[model samples]
Target chain A: MKIADVETPALLIDLDRAEANMKRAQDYADAHDLPLRPHIKTHRLPRFAKAQITLGARGITCQKLGEAEVMADAGIADILVTYNILGTAKLDRLADLHARIRIAVVADNAPVIEGYQARFDDPDHPLGVMVECDTGAGRNGVQTPEEALVLARMIDAAPGLRFLGLMTYPPRDDRVGARLAGMKEAIEADGIAVREISSGGSPGLYSAHETAGITEYRPGTYIYSDRMQVAAGLGTLEDCALSVLATVVSRPTAERAVLDAGSKALAADLSALPGHGHVMGHPDAVLTGLSEEHAVVDISACKDFPAIGEKVRIVPNHACVVTNLFDSARMIRGSGVEETVRIAARGCSQ
Target chain B: MKIADVETPALLIDLDRAEANMKRAQDYADAHDLPLRPHIKTHRLPRFAKAQITLGARGITCQKLGEAEVMADAGIADILVTYNILGTAKLDRLADLHARIRIAVVADNAPVIEGYQARFDDPDHPLGVMVECDTGAGRNGVQTPEEALVLARMIDAAPGLRFLGLMTYPPRDDRVGARLAGMKEAIEADGIAVREISSGGSPGLYSAHETAGITEYRPGTYIYSDRMQVAAGLGTLEDCALSVLATVVSRPTAERAVLDAGSKALAADLSALPGHGHVMGHPDAVLTGLSEEHAVVDISACKDFPAIGEKVRIVPNHACVVTNLFDSARMIRGSGVEETVRIAARGCSQ
Candidate 1:
């Protein structure tokens, strides 16, 4: 099928640009001597993860066990689940996956450790564990270096777990790096060697090297730079590879047009940037509003508005959430349609 | 499977409450002399649509061709697609479904009419078409009464198309009803009978009776009232039948607990009621933040914060969007899992 012949409200990925993006990030990580473990939570496509691995990615990072299972099913062996696995059902899945591949998990609290201890206390084959540090996002992780040491001690003391190192989601801020370094020092003072310190954030990818004692870097959004990345000064709009191919279904007025893509397609992730997304080729147009199935566009300032049934490409505000909204995405290489690839981890939100 | 063992971050629907909510709306529409065309976009389940039919709905409403196709496959013979059918691919599907079911479509532009004329100009099998009016939502539809007349004339002029009447998404605000009524009067003055004036919106479902000449009413979210509906004064929290069963994945501190449900599960639809969602039992707790995989909750104000791994039910800000996030939803009867129903229309965003 031709790219133009694809249906409206569909996900379109520029394969060439995506490959280039992968190479760019890999090159940066190589130059800084950092092993790039790209997070699969962004694309959720094992094909892209394999492409990244082919381009020299160390492994893959998944935010959920279900995502890791899908990635492993795709024959990608090494996986890191960067969230706490608490419940028995999830722990059983984690243990099963651990037996199959090199899997590592992160924890920030005692109950999480206790759950892990109860399920994964087999001394024969130990599970790698990392302590999550609350650098600044304030969403997850321990508050202080002392708390990190406390969790590290518990992981190292566990019979079936090996204390791998420290990990933080957005190791963007310098303070986060300094805090990780201090925690590592405190952890080593207690006679436990920190083998790996992982930090991840696309907006702060370049800053990953500046963070002291970080050995591995993970970046999800770098594969598909979004409106947020561009606004965060990570890269230009030209670096964005993923775009939603939507048709102007209705022109309510001269100043307004409605695209088939809405929150269900483009997602409701409002970046720090103003509108919902950037309408490619129409610099003056802004996605003023979004209903479930329609994106209300204000095209009054455009030099020329698109006609009804005209297809328009949109770079969504947050590519990660948008990628998860679709079941599959059309792979396009310079206007030529490749094949449609199922997002193997699209609804792996467990 | 038992409801407690179903899994965390799952979509749960109270079947009893849903039946009650459906009956409540059906009773109101019957009393008001309006044919209730319950939109299938909320539950997107054939079971619920059939239940609504059993409870006295005239037909069902769908927003996309894909959804309508699913409903048709499930023996729903009468379906109204409330979206403009453009492009050959979608039009082919629409025509195919129209051949099998009593299907009606809406249009507000010439290109849309031209597409319909090209395919369905057969006088033998006329297609029911409605002129969508931009009453007040300003999303899609013709701007004025004259524009509605123009579309109505075009529909009436087409050999294969029958002009049904008018339709608006949100029948809220007195001005919208006045405008719609005026448009109906003007269109009828042009010698074309406006057989039906369809108006929809759960927030304005009760007030739909106040509209001077609306012949049909559609409400989707009434089957599952959400936090947004409550804040809009549509109903109370008790009226909400759908809730996300999310587990506390992590408690980084006594004040903060991370839920397994995030934007992927609960959605990013902000409510006027404040916070991401209403934590059912923890009235004082606030869902302060959400990422792709986790919802950061603030439980400082709560007298008793939930422990790690504890499950909590949450009424999402928008129930319709949340329904689209999952592949299936668990149906519960008084806290016991009755069955798991597949969201047959999920990813039917095309």
Candidate 2:
């Protein structure tokens, strides 16, 4: 079936651009000597995860145990869940996943490490526990290098756990390397080997080499560069591989029109750019507002305003969130659909 | 299962509060002499939709054909899709759905009506079509009452379509009744009978009586009031039936903590409130930001900060979009879960 045959407000992933994106990131990481560990949170499809592994990605990074479980079920051998896995129920699943494949997780606090210590005790498959440090990005991590050492030491002492490395969702700055290096040295000075210095962010992917001491790069959004990534100097609109195919259902006024896709389809995240997303081939038009099922666009400056029922592809502000919005996406080779792929780990947010 | 037994970052609907909310809306509409056509976009569950029907609702309103199809399959005989149903594939689906149940659709443009006219020629199953008037809301509607008459006349003239009424997502104003009355009179003068004047918005549900011309009220968010509803003066925090049951997975600093529910779960729709959501029992704590799988909370003013592993219930800014974010939700009575029900129409964005 063609684009018109499929329903509107569906996800369309350009295979041509996506393959180029994968090869480019893989090639850059290979040249820079940084082991690429692609995060499956962006695509969430096992097809794409397996493709990343085939392209020489060392392993995969999941945001939660639920996501890791989907990847593991797909026969993904090595997985690293980036969040601090707390609570008994999730830890139970972590242990189950651990028994099957090589699993690693990050911890930012003592309680999380203690919970991990209680469940895991196998020497043969000691769970690699990494210390997530706050090297500048203020999301989830220990505040200082001293705190990283404390967690690293605690993880090293646990019989079921092994101290793997230091990880950070680093700020896009030159000092990211120095900040991560400080934590790595503090932990290594205590006799624990800091094997991997994992730093990640799609915006900072090309500048991975500048962050000198990082052993691996874990960029997620590079696979489908969006409007947000373009705003961050990642690439142009041409490099974006994913878009929401929407239909213009209402033309209320000469200057105003509404698309079928809204916050539920295109998502509600706004970038530094003007609108919530970039409307391809309609540069003059701005997406003024979005309700649940309608995206109102201002087409005052448009030379040719879209007629009612005209299909338009919109590149969302944030690509990762959009991936989670749909269960399945159309893989497009040029303008034709190659296949429909399920986002296996879409809502696995444990 | 109990609240603690379920995993983190899941949608929870307090069944007691939800039933109370349903009764309140039905009772209010009965008292105000307005027929209640509850919009199923907020709940998206057949269980709740059937409950609403059982509680004296005239019919259910759906935002899309896909949502209507789900409700129709679940034994809901009467459904009004409050969207401009365009395109051949969707019209084909509409025709199939129309043959099964009593279906009505709204349109603001001639193109949408023409498409319906071309496919539907069954005088026995003539499509019920309504002219959607702007009436001061800038979303999807005809600009003026004159334009509404044109569509209404066109719909009346079609052999396979009947001019049912006029509908609007009206602006919260005292003049709503007058605007609707003007449209009704204009259409009636053109030799077409205007049977139903439908107006919707949970914010304006209480003042629905003041809007003189409207015969029906379609309040969606009243079933699960959120921070947006609270901001709109619908109810207090006690009336909110739905919330994201999230776990505090990271305590980065004394002021900053992170919940497992982020944009993917809680969604990124911001209300008039200061934050993206209101955390139950944490009045001072603010949900400052949200990534895909992490909600950053600012708890500086809190006397009791949530520790890691503590489950927190967050009432999102908008309940409608949050319902679309999940596949299933736990129904709870007080704090205990009754059952898990699928959001049958979640992501049914045609």
Candidate 3:
């Protein structure tokens, strides 16, 4: 079935383009001799994970255990949960997943370490725990390398946990190289051999090799560059494989048109882009704003406004958040929808 | 099955509270002697649609055909789709739905009316078409009352379509009542009986009742007041029945604690709220920013910081968009989750 035959506001994945994106990232990893753990949180489809693994990805990186569980179900043996897992319910689920698959999770707190130890105490599966160091992003992780070492030692001494390495999601600043290098030396001073220093960010993907002690890389959104990627000068619009296929539901004037895909489908993320989203074909058109089910596109910037009922593709600002909005995306290949891949890990933010 | 028993970053709906919300709206409609056509787009749950119908709703209002289809499956007879039905594909689906149930769709353009006429020409089930007039939102609908009448005449001339009445989604400004009255007179001047002048909004629900000519009211978000609603002075935070249950994933500093619910869960809509989202318990703690998987809450305004692994509920700025992010929301009774209700119409943007 072609895209015309499918529903509007549907998640459309250009498979050939997607595969090319997967291979390009893999080729980059191969050229640099770096271990590539493609973040599954972007596509969240097991099929894409398998394709990445087939193209020689070292493993997969999931943001949540729920996402890892879906990947594991699809026979993904090695998984790295880049986020901290706390609470008995989550830790127990993590232990069960660890027992079945080669799994590792990052941590920065003693209570989280103690929780993991208490759950996987007897004949522990040697759950690999990475000390999450705050490189610059102020969301999570320890502030300094000394603080990371403290957490690392606590994990090493824990009954069921194994101190695997140091991990940090650094900010997209120029100081990332210095921060990583400084954190590495501090960990080494504590006599802890950092086996896998997993550092990742699409903006910092090129700088991965420069960071002296980095062993593996996990970048999710790079697989499908979005409006954010283009704005950050990471990738172009053509490199974006995922687009929201929406119809011009209303043409208020020659300058304005409203599409069916709104914040619900496109997501209201303005993180790495100028507005809510970008109209794919109409480069000059600006998605000025979005209501719940209506995307207000200002076509005054374009030479001509699209006619009402015209189907337009939109590249959302952030692809990862948009992926989580849908249960399945229509996989388009050579102008036809080949299959429907379920976004199985969608809404699994447990 | 307490809320504590359920994992964080989950969607919770207090059924008793939701029922109360439903009843209050129904009571208001009865007291004011107005037809309550509760918009189901907010919840997008068939059970809630059925309950609304059972609890004295005149009918149901849907923003899309997908949502209308979901409500139709639950035997919701009278359904008004408050959106322009564009393209042949959507019209065909609309025709099928019209045949199955009493369906009314709003359209603003001649081409949209032509498309509907061509599709439903057989006359087995004539489509009820309302001329959508732009009161002031500037999103969709005809700009002037004359434009509204022209569209109404076009629909009246069409063989397969039944010109029902005038419809307008007024802006959030204070001039809604006068606009509705003017549109009513314009349609009445053409010797056409305006059976329904449907006008309503969660923010303007009270004002809609004050409007002289409106026959029916359609308000969706009132059933679950969001941060937007609260900030708009429509309802209080205590009136919000739905919330994103998130865990403190990271506490990087005394000033910041990151919740697992990010843009994907809480939504990045700062519509009527001061910031991204509002932390429920810590009203002073503002959700300053959000990544795809982490919400950064600034607790510097509060005396205490949220500890890592602690659970916190977040009221998203826009509840409608938040519903679209998840497939199912856990229904809670008192403090515990009773069952998960599928947001069946999620991602059904077609």
Candidate 4:
């Protein structure tokens, strides 16, 4: 099917642009001699994950066990779950997933490590555990080098578990990278061989190599730079490969029009960006607000306004969250559709 | 299965509370002598829609033609699509739906009416058409009463289309209701019998009867009131029927705790509330931020912070949008799960 033939409020991924994006990031990783573990949370489709691996990514990173299960089912072996796996049911799933694939997980405290130890104490294959260091972004991880050592020793002492290294999400500035490097060195001084120091963030991807003692990088949104990424000076609009194709469903007034896509289609992630999304080809027009299925637009600033029934492509504020909104996306090359890839892990948030 | 046995980051609807909510709204409509038409966008389940109908709702209201198709397929004979139906693909679907069910639609402009006229101008059965009146919410509708009359006359003049009446999404304040009543009176004076003046909003559900000409009320969120509704003074936390069951995946620090459910499950809709969601039983805790599959909570104010692996229920900021995020929701009767209902209209946004 052609691109226009696909229904409105649909996700369209430019195949050629996506390939170029993957190649660009992979080249950067190769140049820096850093193993690129592309996070599949950005595009939950297994096909895209396989393509990332084929494009020279060492492995894949998943945020939840449900995502790891999807990657494992798709035959992607090496997986790193970047979040703590809590609860018995989830731990059991994690153990089963580890048995099939080479899986590594992260922990920030002793309680989380205890949960992991309970499930993997006597497994056939040892599970790799990493101490998550909190360099700057206060989402998850240990606070200091002393805390990292504490968790590292606990993982090393646990049965059927191997202390891998250290990992942190979104080391905002250079100081965080240097601090992580210091933590790694301190842990090594305690006679523990740090296999890898993983740090990740799409905003900080280019600077990831500059982070001292970092051997691996995990960047999800590099595949689809969004309005937030653009605002962060990551890349220009040309580098954004994903766009939500929406149709002008209503022209209520000269200044106000509504698109078929809303929070349900484009998501409500503000990303601290102006409005909900950036309307492509019409920078003056802003997405004023969104309801469940209506994206309210203010076109008063625009010299030209989109007419009713006309389709408008929007680069959402955060592409990674928008990817999880749709069930499948139309992969288009130029004006034609390459294929329809089902977002296999669209709601795999277990 | 049991409630605790269900996986983390799942949507759960307390069946009893939902029934109470639906009954309360239905009773209010009955007392006001107005026909209740519950919008299916809230629950999106055939069973819940059927339950609303059995409890005295006249019919169901859908936001999209796709949602209307789902309702019609589930034996719902009457439906009103509240958006301007544009484009040939969607018009064809609307025509097919009208052939199967007693369906009605709305339009605000000439082009949308022209499209409907092209398909239903000579149909086997006449289709109900309403002139969408933009009383206050400037999303989709004609601005003034004169504009409403123009669209109403166009639908009235069409061969196989019947001008049903007027409909507005959020009839804000009493002024909007008064204006819509004036528009209906003006159109009727022009020899057009405006049957069924429809207006809808959960916030304005109780005040719907205050409108002079509104004969029908459509309230969706009353079925599952969310944090937005609670903050709006429509209800309280006890009145919210839906909650996301999440597990404490990590306690990275004394103040920060992460939940397994994030934007993918809870949605990133900020409801003018302090945070993303309301953590039940812990009013002091704030959902500070959300990643794809992780919700970070600030637990500094809480006297007793939840430990790792413990389950916590969160009331999302917006209920309708949260309903669209899940594939299925667990129906609970007190502490026991009644059943799991697949959200039939989850991604019906074509």
TM-score of chain B of each: 0.98, 0.98, 0.96, 0.97
- Across A1-350, the per-residue lDDT of candidate 1 in tens digits comes to 77778998999999888888899899898999999999998899989989889889989999999999999999898998999998888999999999899899999998899889999878889999999988888888988879999999999999999999998886356587778888889999999999999999899887778777889988999998899989988788888999999999999898999999999998888856678999998989999999899999999999997899999999999999998899999999888789998888999988
- Compared with the true structure, what per-residue lDDT tens digits does model 3 show for residues B38-136? 888788898888898898988999988888888888788999999988776778788788778898999988888878878877554578889888878
How many residue pairs in model 3 have overlapping backbones? 5
Residue B60, candidate 3: alpha-carbon lDDT: 92
Please list the residue runs of candidate 1 whose C-alpha ends up more than 4 Å from where it truly belongs after superposition.
none
Q: Which of candidates 2 and 3 reaches a greater lDDT? A: 2
- By DockQ rank, best first, the candidates go 2, 1, 4, 3
lDDT of 1 by residue, B205-302 (tens): 88888888889988999999898888888779988999999888878887898999999999998845578999988889899998988999999999
Each model's DockQ score: 0.86, 0.86, 0.72, 0.83
Which is superior by lDDT, 1 or 3?
Answer: 1
Predicted candidate 3 versus true structure: per-residue lDDT over A56-137, tens digit per residue: 9889999888899988988999999988888877887987898788999988777778787787765446788898888888
Q: Count the backbone clashes (under 3 Å) in each candidate.
A: 0, 0, 5, 0
Q: Report the C-alpha lDDT of model 2 over B1-350, residue by residue, as the tens digit.
A: 78877788899999989999999988888898899999999999988999999999988999999899999999999999999988888999999998999999999999999999998998878999999988888899997779998899889989999889999998887777888888888888888899999999999888888877788989999999999888889989999999999999888899998999999888888755798898999999999999888999999989987788888999999999999988899999876888888889998988
Q: Name the fnat for model 1.
A: 0.87
Query: Model 4 reaches what TM-score against the true structure?
Result: 0.98
Question: TM-score: which is higher, 1 or 4?
Answer: 1
Interface root-mean-square deviation (Å) of every model:
0.9, 1.0, 1.4, 1.2
Per-residue error (Å), model 1, residue B131 = 0.3
Q: Cα deviation of B60 in candidate 1 (Å)?
A: 0.6
Prediction 2 global C-alpha lDDT: 0.90
- The sequence of per-residue lDDT tens digits that candidate 4 reaches over residues B72-118 is 99999989999888888888999899878889999999999999899
